[model samples]
Target: MMQAMTAAVAAMAFAISGQTAPGTTTRPVLSKAEAEPFTPETYLRYSGLYSAPVADPWRPKPIATGRPDYLVGGHGFASVQQAVNAAFRDGGAARRWIGVLPGTYTGTVFIPAGTPPLTIFGLGRPAEVRLEFTIDATVTPAVWAEQVNAAGRYAEGDPAWPMFRSCATKTSATAGLCATVVWAQSTDLQLKGLTITNTLLDTVDRGTHQALALRTDADRTQLENMRLISRQDTFLANADDVTRIARVSVRDTYLEGDTDFVFGRAAAVFTGTHFHLVSSRKAGGGVIFAPNTAPNYPYGFLVTHSRITADAAYQTAPTGYLGRAWDQGASATGYLPGSTPNGQLVIRDSLIGAGFNTVTPWASAATTARPFTARIDEGRDLNDVDHNRLWEHANRLTAAPAPAAGTTTSPGTRR
Candidate 1:
């Protein structure tokens, strides 16, 4: 067994269930009913591997009520901000735990500066009722990006104080462009057991813009059993060498998106998770991951012991990927000689359902600069866009050989 120390003091468990799905190139659907009841051995039967630091504690906290400057329900306060604000309000330094209840509270959440390194543990079983947020990019992109950026140690020292406001990326305007959800800039923050979903994507509500779900811009942040689902450009692991999602562990979670959903310049391990591909009209299935790594950056995305699935109709078209490095020559930040250099994305030892498009994976304009055309046509010839670069990885951990080249999951073949 590998040390599995992909995370510090951490053990990653990657497990899949049932059998393959019909029409798609992925494993079977998990039995939600049987999975609800947890046992020591089969705690995460539905999703396979279980992430500890589990939400075993419970406190029925009040919601949409209560004033700050007072601890509510448990620990610091009722609102996440209130609790965070109270922690650094007096500039006193100490770690604390914020216990949040299970509820579908909807609104934009901003984690500002002075955020103490802490843990937001849910009060119930997994996925009970998640605290979901939806915010517009044009309205608060800068504020969104600044919150996490504040927690970083800038070479310039201290960095700018965080505010729930926008900044300039377009025009002469200094406001909203890189908005994100639940950005934890402070180190040692651990969030376990919640569904963080519906994040506004890379597209701005007004025009060209960027959106994201949770961004661990600080070091030593842990998200255990939390589902990060969104459209394009979902989770941006911005922690680099100096910082990292340092010891970041995403265990037994589900990450879904359409185009380049998981992109960033950070190194993190994604173990025992299901990465689903949303639909795109183009011939190739939607691009699952596009990792933009800084040259000499030590880490990148490591996806293992999970399954890859796409929407029903597109399985034959090739949905999944061992991602190609996104080194767009003109991309301002990732501008490397001719392309952006990226750390490896090893999708290893897991099942690939039919939902994954098996053919023409690396056949995109990002690499070829021309529209894709199927030259090989249903033949195992040289015309197929070579996958040797994508599949022939040195670090990809292996579990089992995929069923076969063209095995489709049906009720009979599905276990």
Candidate 2:
């Protein structure tokens, strides 16, 4: 078996239950009925290769709430995979609910297609419902293969290697080894009050360190009070290369990252959210959003009524930009597969902290000759109309830097 250090740490044990309002005088709640009244325990069965949870001293102990139709951390399912398997066993369209009890889940939780329309809600605050995973993109697949083969962690013909390879890109040498903490691919799904983090420890080499915190390709999806954290490519709201256009609405969420943190081709609406810049010292600053909206698409990223703030560390840099046009013809996949860069975004009625670059607000170039589209419509934005393809509508900057013609890497930088 591979050493514990090579693989993700183990975690388990939690239950889903409700709590009374603050300062409420209501009586104590009743103990949950572990077994459902009519549903067969067999009905909730699913098939998949099961990995035992490794022992991690820091991992939180599971909480056992006796709830039916719910998988508690410690008492019910040993892993979130099992719970998801059970939920999608029949692949029916009936509405179902999965309550995640307070505890940190450490592994990948995939919501596959054809699953029932489901709602996964955390029991407590976002912090309390934590789902964490780690995958360092700096490690090449050959290195991973050699290490895993030497460690003897996985047996021959195991699915781990193939799945790990699937995470990488066609051009990445470490292709098939990139890690995505959460992959949400089902439609009509809802996630509320959860913190999904990618704890890949490679802050030094930010180049190929593409640790994704969450990748959502679901349409008509809703995210409420979600805290998504990672270093690069933190949250991807995009569809598959062949799927239909993705539509998502994120409300009351918190997103933090460094390079192209919020980049995708989805028609996403972010409302009342907080975008934090957690760039490293060498990064100077980073771009927050990189949208690749097609010309025919009406909406791309509509960020309104949100706050963009920087940590004390990130404030040291000149400032970060709001977003850039993600249109790399050769590198672009997913929506608008090979189309020219036509990124559309609208930041309106938002409070941008002083940590942003007031001068060159958008990144002008990613490569030597490849510049972003210079004709981003101003629509009704109040800021100066000099910046290329990046328009703002009633946004406030803190540092208030002098205005400039174009930018090298001022507001947004290349990935």
Candidate 3:
């Protein structure tokens, strides 16, 4: 009996001290879920695995040049963009990774056609290396703004007679049309650990394309742990067509712009991200997720697990919306008058900070109880082809419960 009791106690001691469970031994098993402290590598690993899955069908291998010479001048490529071009153009190499060492390169990057999926991993997320540039529509390859035709299509023949000559380049409060870098057709372009910025924020003259640090016609891209800073139109997503679909995921990233800085018609998802609203301008143009869908697709925009801030400096009674359905040439397309009820926007499990216009909608007149033509069964909220429209407050925005408290975020929003 004594031997039996002694053996049982020994077994219990072994079970407790041998560390089958957590907190039992001096050195516990390091969970793959935990982040590494005080190390850039930890950020790299955390961002790599959790930020967002490569939205591409198949993630191409990382391109490694055997040596670091692909980096021009032994630091960054002759251009940050040239390195990107090399990675995607070369079909022979498997693991394609443009390892940008630490530095700031100034120039506009163009991701032309025939580029493949790319992953540009830097030393740390948006820290070790950076790309910054500025371009203006005033001095663009010659910009032209056209109106929609009778058939509700983009009319391309005429240009807006230059109203204001020479809109000087300066970071201002109003939104403009310039872009620092732009991409097209490319998918799964990963911007990891880099700071992309534009210094042109001054909107004194107005009616100019406020330069953007990053703009893309690219589809299905992911930005992780990157910082995007600009006053207006900081990030622009232009599409070749509204009907064709493009998906974007911005995870664990930071975006700070002055007025309506984030606007695009692309279907996008923002998760665990931060939005910075600046204070310089009285124009209350706020952040917006324009579901530029073709009034046909199901999902337009998805925002989950993110935070918004109207900069403390913005004291002039900021005048815009948390978001609004954009009117892309509504004055031209009678379609603009019919745009309100067609938007599909979802905001879940996210925190909406102030600088948001809570009283009135920032949506265009196209969204205010406009006439519906081919009206479907909308129950009662939409009844007439003339008077019924989408209710703006229909979705007041709410967050659903997560199972493990913080393991995963809500799904992407559809516009």
Q: Which one wins on lDDT?
A: 2
Task: Write candidate 1's Cα lDDT for 80-126 as tens digits.
Answer: 55555556554445556666666664533445445665666666554
* Deviating ranges (above 4 Å) for candidate 1: 1-78, 90-93, 112-114, 136-163, 166-177, 199-210, 240-247, 280-284, 316-322, 332-340, 363-415
lDDT on C-alpha atoms for all candidate structures: 0.46, 0.57, 0.46
Q: Write the per-residue lDDT of candidate 2 for residues 1-415, one digit (tens) a residue.
A: 1122112111101121222211011111111221111121121121111122122112111122233365647687855555666787746677677778889987777676666876777777778888887765567766544432343433333333344345432456673323567777787777877889888734457565777888887665678777888877789887554224666777777888877789776767776677877655236557888876544443467776676766554555656766776664534342242345456666655566655565555764342223433332323221212222344554434542333467322211110
Clashes of 3: 36
Candidate 3 C-alpha lDDT tens digits along 1-415:
2243234223323211111112111111112221112121211121111113232242222222334324633545666666755655564434355666777766555554445555665664355466765555444332311110112122122111111121122344322443454434455576666777775555443333466777665565677767777665677754544545555667777777655566665656665676666655435555554444435333445555565545533323545455544445554444432442244444543454444554443444232323222222322222232332222211222222223554532111100
Clashes of each: 25, 15, 36
Distance from true location, Cα of 8 in model 1, Å: 26
Candidate 3 accuracy as lDDT: 0.46
